[model samples]
Each structure stands twice: as structure tokens, then as C-alpha cells.
Target chain A: MQGLFVVFRKELCDHFSSYRFVILFGLIAMVSFITSYMAGVHMKENLEALSKTRFSFLMLFSTPGALFSMVQFVSFFGPLIGLVLGFDSINRERAQGTLIKLVSQPIYRDAVINGKFLAGVATISILLVSIVLVISGFGLALVGVVPGIEEIWRLFIYLIISIFYISLWLGVSILFSILFKSIATSSLASVALWIFLSFFVTLGAEVAANAIAPMDRKKETKPEILIKNTRIKERVSLSSPMVLYSKATEIIINPMRKTTGSIVMMMPMEQILSSRFQNPLPLGQSVIIVFPHMTALIAITLICFAISYLVFIKQEIRT
Target chain B: MDADTIIQTVNLTKRYGKQVAVDDLNLSVKEGEIFGFLGPNGAGKTTTLLMLLGLSQPSEGSASLYGLDPLRKATEVKRLVGYLPENVGFYEDLDAIQSLEYVANLNGINKEEALGKIDKLLELVGLKNDARKKINAFSRGMRQRLGIAEVIIKDPKILFLDEPTLGLDPEGAIWFMDFIASLNRDRKITVLLSSHNLSQVQKISHRVGIMINGKMVADGSMESLAREKFGVGDKEYSLEEIYMEYFQEV
Candidate 1:
């Protein structure tokens, strides 16, 4: 326990002091700041329309800003923060010959891996919380509206999910760092995995959906075929961490979002009956809607971290 | 095993797939002795050292330090043994004091106590003036000197040095050997120095062990080994000739 704390403190200090960390933090903060600012300005212009809404304050986060919402932007770029922090965590020490010296100390082998993992998670939490608070403060100033207690609770839950989502990537990068001996190879492999999961998975989902449910060009597309296509796409894209995280955050941040699957699933008759109610979902209902997604995200994060921990403990330190 | 033995290996073996890295080797070193470990590049000297220090586990057999199994009581064994790898490295972004402080911290030394000890160790290694310099700016000799300070930061009972003088100049190498010898004498610390440089090892080692192809080929003092190979009354054989003779035989 003592050794673990020692390593954790040292790693945390190193993370904060590294130039790479500062640059990455700056990039994320600047991009997210611009995104929230745009959303705030748009909300401010349409105050009368947004005033009747249940969670108007949260629109600053869920509304489209510039090109994408703050949630969407984070889902796309947050993994980079995780990847950069962990891609070289172990391999760089091995390459520099510090690993042997470290392990030779009177400390349990697991302490090294556990300490690094905790430090990475801590850094992610710090980054996410600060970014969310800064954006919320800007939103308050621009829209002249304060978040209610329920809104605060929802935002807190959103932050937790985001942390878990990014940490999944951190665990993956740390796994690569342990498997590959060279820092360059580990980093390249991490980035490649990130790209495959983030972008290619969606494209593959489209292809898979099309192959599964072909849409004929000769006749007008049937609603049944389109519904089947949407279902297949949603199910297949769930294989990706980014998709899972985005879906979960979208529903959590926007209470108006009540479903995880296709809108076509809601029958026309049912839509007519439900259209009379413009009330947003309660906090409990929103959480229940995304429970499966949150579960999958947390499970995958734990599994990835468990694998990295095992591999690091079992690996031979020959260099 | 003798009562004074600080390190002992019983049929110690390590295998990577079908090839053996360290064979069923039986070796022991007593407390407070500078034991020279001489071997070629692929002779498994480093592998055995790693196993002894609990850094690597053997596929078969076992090793013990202070009668504690390295494989099981790893933390305890490591507390008593310090290992300096062939090419020792430090965190390049950190200065000398910071680097040593990290090592000190890992060994569970408090900041107040570590600072004072670090200052003395830095002065001993002649790195006092460069205490605030980043490791990236340090030369090879300075790194090796710092490596020594790091190894002894915990006041370990034994030292395992693998190719510690590989990159040093002749003068530097001599100085390093002398420093190690003095450390052994004054502190009563057992030293296991592995190197390919026979002259330096022959100068201070109370006894020497030669390993070849994952096996200990010869183990004895200079006088004993010379007498066993060359009959009594022959001119003193340089470790080079003895080492060559063993090399040719093997």
C-alpha cells in the first residue's frame, strides 16, 4: 500500500509536469470552450423559445454548437487524451531501462500497474470536471439561467459516464504499452485501434446494415426495410466504445431523448397519442433509458483494465 | 550451503521456449565478498543475476537471498538485494536530485531522511555539482555513477552489478572498480559484479565465476583456479590466459 501510494504520487506529478499533457489539455479546452460558447450564443438568441423547455440550461451542452454538440465533440476527441497519457506508460520506461530499477525495489509488482492506472483515471476525472464546470459557468453567464438541482445531478452522471468511457481507452493504450516493447509501436497501435473503433465501426455498421437489409432503388423504400436497417445499424455500432458512450451521453444530456433505437419503432398511432405530451423525461427515466449502455461501458472498461493488469504482472522485465 | 552465504541458487534454470537461458546452475556467494561474475555476451550472467534479485522468475529450481525464496518472498529478497542492469537508465526529464529522490521514494524512504542521504551519496559519486542537471544532459559516466547511488539508496545488503563499466573509459573503469571495492570493504556489503573485462574483475574479486551457455563452467579464486589448471610453481597466470583456456575447453 505504501509503495502503491509512492508510485501513484510520482506518476501524478509526472503527468501534470509533462509538456505533452499541457498541449493536449490546451487543445481539448480550447475546442470545447468554442463549442459551448457557440451553443450558449444560439440559446441566448432563442431565449423565449428555450424558456418553456424543461432543461433549457442543459441545451448549452446538448445543442449543436458550430459543427457538433459538446457531447459529440467529447466522444470523438476525448479518447486522444486517454491514448496519449497511456500509450507510452510502460514501454517508455522499458526502453529507458527504468523498469528494471523500479521493479527491483521492495514493492509488490502489482503496485506499479495499479498505481499508473489510478493516476490516469484521476487525471481524466480532473480534466473532465474542470472542463464541464468551465463550460457550465460560461453557459450561466450567457443564457442568464442557472441549473436546477436535477440538472446538476444529470450533469454529474454525464461526467461519470464520460470518465469511464475515456478510461476504457486509457486501459487499452496501457495494454498496448505492456505488449509492445517499443514506445513508437505501442503508440501507433493505440491510434490505429482508436481510429478503427471511432470511425470505421460506424462505416462498417452501415455496410452490414445494407447487406442485411437491401433497399431496392427501383421502388419506393418501404418503412419496414428502413426500420430493419436502422435496427441493424444500431445493434452493430454498439460494438464500438465511442458509439456506446455517445448514445449514453446523448440520452443523459438531453432528457427529450427517450429511446436508444430507431424513431421508426414508435408507431404513427402511438406518436400521435404521445405528441400531446411535450414533457421531458425525469432524471430516473433518462438513467433507466441508458442503463444498458452505461453498464456496457463500465464493464468494458473494467475488462480492459483487468487484462492490462494481468499482462503487466506476468510479463518478464529483461531490458 | 554455508552459514555465511548471502546468495544461493539450487539447480536454478530458466528456459525460453526450447532454448535454455540459464541451466541447472548451482552457485553461492558469501556475505561481505566482491564476487566477480565473468561471461560472454550470451552466457546468461545477466539472466542469473536477474533471477537472484527477484526481477525474473526461473522456470525450474529456485534461488534464495538470506534464506528467503526470491520467487515467493520477492519483496523481502529485493529489500536486501540491489540490481544495476547493464545499461542503467533514469527518467530523462528529471534532474539528478529528483531522480534519486524517486528511487528513494520507491524504497519507502521519507523525504527528510532521503534528502540528506541523497546529498551525501551525490557527493560520494562526484555528482554533487550536477545535482540539479537533467539526466538527458548527462554523459555515460555520470549516469553510471548515479546508477550506483540509486542501487545503494536503500542500504541494501548485497549489490548486483551487470556490465557497470561497459561504457566507461579506462580511467573511469578503474575508478569505478575501486569505488565498488571500497564500498564492499567499508560497508561489508556483498558484491556480485558481472563483466567481460577480466583485468578489472581480477584486481578486486575475492573469487570469480565463469559462465558459458547458461552454465557455470568454473568457480574458484584466482590462485585456486590457476593451480588446478597449471601445476604448482608456474608463473602467475593472467585472468586473460585462464579465461581463454576455459573458453577454448568449453
Candidate 2:
């Protein structure tokens, strides 16, 4: 434990002092601030246009439209931050020749990798939570409204789940970083994976699924038919983190309220509460749902760490 | 070869496909002796040192440090040995002091004691004035000096230095040799130094092992090896000449 802490301190200090962390924080802050400003503008317009109507503040909760906008922005930006922080974690050490010095110490090889992974996760968490707090504060101040207890609880849950989601990507990036020897190669590999997961994978899945289950060629598809098809497409695409996060956002932004004549429309208040967006599952079930993602994150991180440890242990310190 | 042997290797071998890096080597170093391991660039000097330090595994045979198996007890051996790699580096953004302190912490030194030792080591290496400067801004000599300080921070029982003065100027090289000699003499530290700088090794080492083609062809006191192999009866023989003569025969 003492050795781990010592390594952790050094790793964290390295990140804090290096240009990588500074650039990452600056980039995230810029994007979050821009998104928050846009959200405020849209909220103000909605309130002004609806002031003369009979719609109450409760109507605002029905869609939690502004909060969903923030979620969408975060989902896109969060993984970018994760990839940037993790893509060079190991390759940088190899390039700089610090791995030799580090492995020569009395500490266990496992401790070095564990300490680094924890430090990376901690740095990402700090940056992400700070952004969340800032954007939330800005939203509340601009809207001149305090969320109810339920809404606040849902938002907190959403943030926690988002952390796990981003960590999954970070773990993947670290794995690639360790597998490759050059920083450019590792970075390019991580970015390429990110692009595939974020954009192309879903499109490919859609094309494949449609090919497998072709639509009827004789009849034009109805709106209801399209909406049903879209939902099925969404379920299929949720295999990727980006798509999973989008599904999560859909659940949070639109919750079930009262049963309508046909389509069960969520009530305005229920929408607000749901829009704040707790995990779709109950506490226990949420854990089950998140456990696989968390396990995948942890498993890949350890595998990369183990490979690095083995390599460091066996590598001749020629330079 | 009794209890006083700090390092011992029995038939230690490393091979890359058909090319052997270190072949069937048997060697030992006494507790406080300065043992010089001299070899050509590709003669497997670094491979031998890496195996001895538990950084690399042997394809066959075994090695021990202070009676602890290097392969099985690497962490234990590492705790008692300080290794200075051929071209050592630190986190380039950190200054000399920060880098040393980090190494100290990794070695389980107490924070207060580590700070005191860092100061002493910086002074010992004549790097106190440049302690706060980042390593990226340092000269090759400065980096070498800092590397020396880092390895000696905990005052480990054994010091394995691979080409400690590789890139230094003559003045820096002499300064390093003097410092190494003083450490061996005054502190009784066991030193296993691998270098192609034969003259410097000849000056500071108590015993020298000359390796050629993955074999220790000659191993003894400098004076003894010269007398026995190079016929240094009345005249002194330079290490370069001895090395040339040994290789010429092969």
C-alpha cells in the first residue's frame, strides 16, 4: 500500500506538471462552457415563448430538454477526454526511457501499473466532475430555478454512471497504449477505435441488421413502423459505449408518467424527474447492468498492466 | 566464495535464436570489491548485467545475489542493489531533486531521510547547484551525475553500473571515477561496473573480467592478468593493448 501510494503520487505529479493534462483540461473546459452557454440560450427562449401559455414550470420537467442537451454534449466530449489521457500513458514512458528507472526500484512491477491506472482514472474523474459541477451551476443560475430532491438525485446518478462509461473507454485506450511501442502508433490506434465505436460501428450494425431482416418491398413503411424499427435499431446499436450512452440519455430525458389513450405519454412532472435521469434499472439491477461494463474496463486495464509488467521485468536496460 | 560473495552466477546463459548473448557463464564478485566487466559492444556485457540485476531472465542456469535467487527473489535482490542503466533517464519535466526524491520513495526510504540523502547525494555528485533545474535542460554530464545520485540514494549494498561515464567529457569521466573509487574505498560498497572504457575501469577496479564473444576469456587482477596473458614483465601494458592482443588471438 505504501509503495502504491508513492508511485501514485509521482504519477499524479507527472500528469499535473506535464502539458498533456493541461491541454486536456483546457479542451474539456472550453467545450463544456460552450455547451452550457448554448443550453442557457435555448432555455431562455423556451421560457420566454411559454410565459403567456397555461403551461406551468412542471411542463419543463416533462422533457428536461435542457438537461438532455447537456447529456448529449457530455457523451460526445467525455470519451475524447478519456482517449487523450490514456493513449500515451505507457508509450510515453517507454519513449522517455523512464521505464528502466522505474522497474529497477524495489517496488513490485504490478504496483507501477496499478498506480498509473488509478492516477489516470482519478485525473479523468476530477476533470469530469468539475465540468459537471460547473455546467450544473451555470444551468441553475441561468434558469433561476432549484431542482427538487428527486431531480437532483437523478442527476447525481447519471453523473456516476457516466464515469463508468468514460472509464471503459480510458481502459481501452490504456490497453492500446501498452500494446504499442510508439506514442504516435498508440494514439492513432486509440483514435481509430474511438471513431469506429462512436460512429461507424452503429452504422454498420444498422446496415447488417437491415440486410438480415429486409423491409417489405411492396408496401411503403408507415411512421409507426419506422419508429418501431428505430427502437429495435437503437437496442442493437447499444452494444457500443456511444450508443449505450445515447440510450441512457433517452431513458433519462423521457420517463414514463401517465398512460395515454394509445401511446403512454409521460406527465410533465414525471418527465422532469426522469429527465434528471437515474439509471434505468433499480439499484441492484443497475449494479448488474454496470458490472459487465466495469468488469470489462477493469479486465482490459489489468491485462495491459500485466503485459507491461512482464515486458518490463524481462526487458534488458540497454539504454 | 563463502558468505562474502555478493553476486554469483552458475552457467548463466542467454541466446537469441542461434546467436548467444551470454553463454555458459560462471562468475562471482566479493562483497566489497570493485569488479570490472569489460567487453566489446556486442560481446553480451549488458545481457550479463541485466541477468545479474534480475532485469532479464536466463534461458538456462541460475544467478543469486546475497544468497537470494535473482529470478525468484528479484524484488528482494532489487531492494539491496542500486542499478544505473547505460543511458539512464528520469521524467524529463522533473528537476534533479524531484527525480531523486521519487526514486528514494520507491525504494521505501523515509521522506525526511530521503530529503537529507538527496541533499547529500547532490552535494556528493557536485549537482547541488543544479538540483532544481529540469533534466531536459541538463547536459549529458549533468544527466549522468544525476543518474549516479539516483542509484546511490539508498546506499544499496551492491551497485550495478553499465557504462556510467559513456557520454561524459574527460573531466566528467575522471570526476565519476574518483567518486566511484571513493565510494568503494570509504563506504565498502560492492560495485559491478560494465564499461568499454578500459583505462577508467583498470584504474578503479580491484579485479577485471575481459569478455570476448560471450566468454570471459581473462579474469583476474589487472596486474596479474597483464603479467600472465600479455607478458608485462618490466614494462606496463595499457588495457587497450591487452584487449587488442586478446582479440587478435581469436
Candidate 3:
């Protein structure tokens, strides 16, 4: 345990002093602030109508800017922060020959992997907390809206979900670092997985839905087939951590969001017209909606970390 | 097992799938002796060293350092042993002092104590002037010297060095060998020196082991090995000669 703390402190210092940390932090913080600032300005412009709305402060995160809202930006690119931090975590040490020297110390093998993971998590937490604080400060200044207690709680939960989402990628990249021997291979593989899971998985889900329940325009498609298509698409998309993360975070940040299922199925002509009078669900209900998503995100992240841990412990540090 | 034996392996073996890396073998080094570990590449010298250090698990038999099973009591065994790999590495971004301090902290040394010892160690390794220099700017000989300082930071009971002088010039290698011999003499740190440089190993080793094809073909003092193999009186055989004879027979 003492060894774990020693390695953790060393790795944390390494991460902080690294140039890549500065670059990645600057990149993410700049983009997030830009999107949130735009959202704040956009909300301020429509202040008269939005002032009466509950939890209006959260619009800074959910309201779209020129291209994406703050939430969308995080969902799409936050994995890059995680992947960059961890893709070469183990292999770089191996290549540098530091790993053998490290493990040869009077420390348990598990300490090295556990300490590295905890350090990465700490780095990610620091990055996320500062960004969230900066965005909230900007939002408060621009929108002139003081968040209520419930709004603060929602924002805090959003931050937690975002960290988990990004950490899933961190675990995955660290796993790749252990499984592959070359830094190039691990980094490339991490990026490829990120691209496929976050961006291409949506396309893949659509394609899978079409194959499973294709809608033939020649004849009127059955309602059952339409429903099945939506279900299949949702099911397939859920396989991606990005999809699960975005869905969970969107609901957590926006208390008005009612369900995680297909929005198409949840809406109909009359329901939309009548839904205006429906009160926004409370935080407890919002949490209930995304509980499954959160559990799955946490589960996959743990599994990734566990596998990497086992492989590293059992591996021979020959290099 | 002798009471004074600080390192011992009993029928230790390692198999990488169908191919054997280190075959069943018995080897031991006594306390305060410079035992040379000589073998050609792929003769399992590195593999044996790794197993002895508890970095690799043996498929058969057992190894003990100070009567503690290396596999079961790895941390304890490691606390008493220090290993300097063929190409020992340090964090390139850290200076010599910072690098040694990290090793010191890993061994549970306090900051003040570590800082004080690191200064003396840098001087001992003749890197006093470069103590503040980053490892990236260091020459190979300088890095090896820093590596020597790193291994002995914990003041271990034994030291295992693999190809310690591999990249040094002749003069540098000789100097490094003498430094190691002096460490053994002054600190009584049992040394297991593995190298391809037969003459250098022969220069300082009190006893030597020659391994081939994962097996220890010959192990003993130089005179005893020559007397047993040649059965001649007053005959001398260098480690290079004995090493070549084993390779020829294999």
C-alpha cells in the first residue's frame, strides 16, 4: 500500500509535468469554454422567456452553440483526453527499460498498475473539475442566473457521469498499453477504438437496424417493424460507451429529459401538444431513467481495468 | 544448502510453451563472493537471473534468497537483493539526484536521509559533477555509474548485474569491473556478475558458473574446474577457455 502511494505520487507528478498534459488540457478547456460561452450568450438573448423556466442555468451545458452544445463536445472528444494520457502508460516504461527497474523494487506487482490507474483518474478528475468550474462561472456571469440547490446537484451529477465516461476510455487505453508491446500500436489502436465507438457506432447502429427491420417504401411499413427498427438501433447504439454516456449525461443535466428510450417512440402528435403542461421530473426521477446506463458504464470500466491488472501481474518483465 | 549461501535455486526450470528457457538446474552463490555468471546469448543467463529475482516464475522447482522463497516472499527477497539489468534505465526527464531519490523513496527511505545518501552515492560513482544533469544528457558510462548507485541505494545483501559493462570502452569496462570488486570488498555485497566478457568476469570473480542450453555445464573456482577437467597439476585455464570447451562439447 505504501508502494502504491509512492508510485501514484510519482506518476501524478509525471502527468502534471508532461507537455502533452498541458496541450490536452488547453485544447479541451478552450473548446469547452467557447461552447459554454456561446450557450450562455444564446440563453441571455432569449432571457425574457427562459427566465421563468426551472433549472435555466443548465442550458449552458445542454443548449447547442454553432455546432455542438458543451455536453455534445464532451461526449464526442473527451475520450481523446483519456486515450492520450494512458495509451502509452505501460509500454513506454517497458520501451525505456524503466519497467524492469520499477518492478524489481521491493513492491507488489499490482501496486504499479493500480497506482498508475489511480493517478490517471486523479488527473482526469482535476481536468474535469476545473473545466466545469470555469464553464459554470462563465454561465453565471453571462446568463445572470443563480442556480438553485437542485440545479447545482444536477451539474455535480453530470460531472460525475462525464468522469466515468472518460475514465472508461482511460481504462481501455491502459489495457491496450499492457496488451501491445509498441507505443505506436497501442496509441493507434486506442484512437481507432475511440473513433469506431463514438462516431462510427451510430452509423453501424443505423445499418444494423435497416438490416434487421428494413422499411420498404413500396408498401406501407408495419408499425411493429418501425418499432423494432427503433428498438434495434437503440440497443445497438447502447453498446458504445459514448452513446451510453451521452444519453446518461443529457438526462442528468436536463431534468426536463423524461426517458432514455427512443425519442421517436416517446413522442406522438397529441402527446407533444399536451406535454407542455407536464412538470419537469425531479432529480430522483432523472436518476432512475439513467441508472442502467450508469451501471453499464461503470461495469465496463471496471472490467477493462481488471483485465489489464491481471495481464500485467502475470506478465514477465523481461524487457 | 550451506548456511552461508545467500542465493540458491533447487532444480529451477522455466519453459516458454514448448521450448525450455531455463532447464532444471541447481545454482547458488555464497555471501560476500563475486560469482561470475557466464553464458552465450540464449543460454538462459538472463532467464535464470529473472527467476532468481522473482520477476519471472519458474515452471518447476524453487528458488530462495536468504531462505525466503522468492515467489512467495517476493517483496522480502527483493528488499534484500538489488538487480542492475543489461541496459538499466532511468526517467530521462529526471536528474541524477531526483532519479536516485525516487529509488530511495521506493525502498521506504525518508527524504532527508535519501538526499544525504544520494549526495555521497553520486560522489562514490564519480558523478558528483553531473548530479543535477538530466539522464537524457548522460553518456552510457555515466548512466551505468548512475545505475550502480541506483541498485545499491537500499544497501542490499546481494547484487545481480547483467552485462553491466556491455557498451563501455575497454578502459571504462575495466574501471567498472574494479569499482564492482571494490564494492564487494568494502561493503561485502555478494555479487552475481553475468557477462559475455569472459576476461572481465575472470578478472574479479572468485567462483564462476558457465551455463549452456538452459543448463549449468560447469560451476566452480577456476583452479578447481581446470584441475577436474584436465586432471593436470599446476595448469591454469582462463574462463574464456573453459567457456569455449563447454560450448564445443554442446
Candidate 4:
């Protein structure tokens, strides 16, 4: 633990001093602030539409604007911040001939990986907190409403979820760093994997859903088939880190969000509508709603961390 | 192992598939002695060093540092030793003092202690004036000098330096040698200097091990190897001749 702290402190300082953090912080801050302002504006329209005189100002974070909402933007760009910070974490040290020197210190090799992962998580945590505070503060003025206590609690939970989501990407990028020798290879491979997982997965999910449960509008008149198609489509897309994060964040930020499943056969139209349009589910319900999504992200992140740790410890430091 | 031996290896071997990197090697270095390890390219010098540092596992046999197996007790072994690799570098953005102080903290040295020790060590390495300069502005020799400071930051019981002067100019090489000699003599720090440069090794080494094709071809003092190879009372011959005699291509 002592060695971990030592490595963490130095790594955090390294991030602060490096241009990588400066550029990422600037990029995220700019895009997120812009999205927040737009979301703040859109929250006004949502309030008037819903005809709710009193709603959670926290909804501003989830309100979809002309282009994108803040949480959507976070879902899109959060991984960028994570990948950029971690793609070269270990290989860069090796290239600079510092890895041998580092391991030769009294600290265990595990300390280095632990410190690096913690530092990345810490960076993501700070970035998310700032985004939430800024957007929430700005929402108060633009939307002319104070957030409810429950909304504030949900937002805090969302922040924790956001950290885990970003850490998933950090873990992936660090895994590449250890697996590859050159920084160029690792960074390029990280970005390539990011593109595949973030963009292609969404497209592929649609294709796979169509193939698995084709509409076949001609004979498949059964409503169950359509329902199954929708569920499969949602499942395929939600498997992605982007969709999982957006799903989790959307429910947390928009307290009104109720169920994540499609229920045509299970409930009559009137009953489904009443439940869906009902007042925001209790805090516990909302948490339960997103718990699976959050767990998947956290589980994958831990798996990545585990693989990187095992490979790094067993790796030969020839130089 | 002798009572005075700080490092002991018996029948230690490492092989990559069909090729052996370090054959059944038996070596022991006593406390407070400068042991120079000389080898040609692909002679398994770096591999042997890696095994010693517990970075790579041997296919057979074992090695110990101060009676502790480095593989099982790596942190304990590392705590008592320092290593300076060839072509060592610092984070180009960090100044010398910042870099050293950062490593010192990793060694569990307190900030106040690190600050003071870093200042004096930088002076010892003749890099005191460049403490605040970014590493990018420093030359190779300056970086090597800083590498020395980083190695001794915790004042380990022994130092493992592999080609520490590999790329230095003649003057820089001399300065590095003098600095290392001072560390070994004045501080009584055990030194294991590995290099292909026979002259530098002969200058500071009390004993020498010459490795060829993953095996120790010879191990002894200069005179001992000289007499043994060419018989006693042989005419003058530098360590280079002794090396070329065993390694000559012709």
C-alpha cells in the first residue's frame, strides 16, 4: 500500500506535468461545458412538455439537446480521456529505460500497476465531479429549478457509475500498453479497439438483431416477435461499453426513467402507460434499474486489471 | 556460499526454447569487492543480469542475494540493491531534482530526507547545477550522471551497473569510472559492473568474469587469468588480448 501511494503520487504528478492531461482536460472541459449549456436550454422545453411544475433540475444533465446531451457526450468522449491517459503507461516507461529501474526499487511490480490504475480512476473521478457540479450549477440558472434531494443523491450515484465506466476503458488501454512493445503500437491499437467497440458494435448490434429476429412483416404478425426483436436489439447494443454507460447514466440523470425492459405481453396498454408515465421511480428502484449495467462495466474493468497485472508480473524485463 | 559472499548462484541456467541464454552458471561475489562482468554481444550478459534481478526465471538451479532467493523475496532483494541499465533515461519533462526526489519517495524516503539527500547526491554526480533543468536539455553524459545519482539515492548495499558508460565520450567515461571507484572504495559499496569494455573493467575490477556463448569462459583477477592462459611469467598482455585470445574469430 505504501509503494502504491508513492507510485500514485508520482504518476498523478506526471499526468499533471505531461501535455497529454492538459490537452485531454481542455478538450473534455470544453465539449462537456458546451453540452451542459445546451442541455440546460433543452431542460426548459422538457419541463414545459411534461407539464410538471416541479421536476428534478438534475434532469438537465440528461435532457437531449439539438446535437447531444451531456451524459451522451460523456458516454462518447469519456473513453477518449481514459484511453489517452493509459495507452502508453507501461510501454513508455520501458522505452525510456525506466521500468527496470522502477522494478528494482523496493516496491513490488503490483504497486506500479495499482498506482497507475488508481491515478487514472482518480483523474476520471475529478473530471466527472467537475462536469456534474458545473452542469448542475448552470442548470439552476437556465432551468430555473432547484434539484430535489433525491435527484442530488441519484446524481452522486451517477458520478460513481461514470468513474467505473471510464475505468473500463482505462483498463483496456493499459492492457494494450503492457501487451505491446512500442508506444505507437499500443496507442494505435487502443484507438482501433475503441472504434470497434464504440462505433462498430452499435452498428453490428442492429444488424445482428435484424438477423436474429427479423421483422418478416409478411407472416410474423405475432407482437411477441417484435417485442423479442426489440429486446434482442437492446441487448446487443447495451453489451457495448458506450451503450452500457449511456443506459446507466440516462436512468440516473433522468429520475423519471422507469423500466429498461420491453413489456407488451406482460402488461395491458393502459397499465404499461400508467407505470411508464408515473412519477420517477423511488431512488431504490432507479438504482436497481441500472444495477446490472453498472455491474457489467465494473466486472469487465476488473477483468482487464487482472489480466494486465498477471502479464506484467510474469513479463521479462530484458533491458 | 562463503560467509563474505553477498551473491551466490549455483548451476543457474536459463534457456529460450532450444537456445540457452545462461548455462549452468556458478558464481559468487564477496562483500565489498568490485566484480566486472565482461561479455560479447549475445553472450547472455543482459539475460544473466535480468535473472539476478529476478526479472526473468531460470530454467534450472537458483540464485540468492544475501541468503535470500531473489525470486521469492524480490522486494527484500531490491531494497538492498540498485541497478543502472544501459542508455538510462529520465522523464524529459521533469528536472533532475524532481525525478530523483520522485524515485526517492518510492524508496520510502521521507520528503525532507529526500530533498537534502538529492541535493548532495546531485553534487556528488556533478549535476547539482542542472537540478532545475529539464531532462530534454541535458546531454547523454549528464543523463548517465543522473542515473548514478538515482541508483545510489537509497544507498543500497550493492550496485548493479550494466554498460553504465556505454555511450559516454572518453572524458565522460573517465569521470563515470572515477565516480564509481569512489562509491566502491570510499563508501565500501559492492559494485558489479558489466560491460564489454575490457579496459574500464580492468581499471576498477578486483575480479573479472568473461562470458562467451552463454557460458563463463574464464573468471579470475587480471594476473591470474593472464598467467593461467599463457602460463606463469608470460610476457605483458592487456585484458583485451586475454579476451581476444578466447573470443578471436580467426
Q: TM-scores of the models, in the given order? A: 0.98, 0.86, 0.98, 0.95
- Model 2, B37-127: lDDT tens digits are 8888889988888788777889999999999987778789888888888888778878898899889888889989999999998998899
User: At residue B97, what lDDT does model 3 achieve?
Assistant: 95
Candidate 3: tens digits of C-alpha lDDT, residues B124-236: 99999999998999999999999999999999989999999998989889989999999999999999999988899899999999898899999999888887677776657
**Cα lDDT of model 4 by residue, B1-250, tens digit:** 5799988889999999999999999888999999999888888888877788888899999999899888999989888889888788678888999899878988999989999999899889999788899999999999999999998999888999989888899999989988888999888899889987788888999999988888888888889988877887748778999998877732
Cα lDDT, model 1, residue B185 = 90
Candidate 1 CAPRI category: high
Q: Output the worst ten-in-a-row residue range by lDDT, candidate 1 chain B.
A: B225-234
- Where is model 4 more than 4 Å wrong at Cα? A45-53, A218-220, A263-266, A269-277
Q: Can you write out model 2's per-residue Cα lDDT over A171-277, one digit (the tens) per residue?
A: 77777777788888988988898888788878977786566555566897665555555555655675567766655543443333211111323445766765585
Ranking of predictions according to DockQ? 3, 1, 4, 2
Q: Write the per-residue lDDT of candidate 3 for residues A8-126, one digit (tens) a residue.
A: 99999999999999999999999999898888888888889765678888889999987899999999999998999899999999999999999999999999999999999999999
Comparing only chain B with the true structure, the TM-scores of all models are 0.98, 0.96, 0.98, 0.97
True contacts kept of each: 0.86, 0.78, 0.83, 0.81
Give candidate 2 misplaced runs (Cα > 4 Å): A44-68, A216-236, A252-319
- Give the chain B TM-score achieved by candidate 4: 0.97
Clashing pairs in 3: none
Model 2 chain B: worst 10 consecutive residues (lDDT sum): B223-232
- Considering only N, C-alpha and C atoms within 3 Å, which residue pairs clash in candidate 1? none
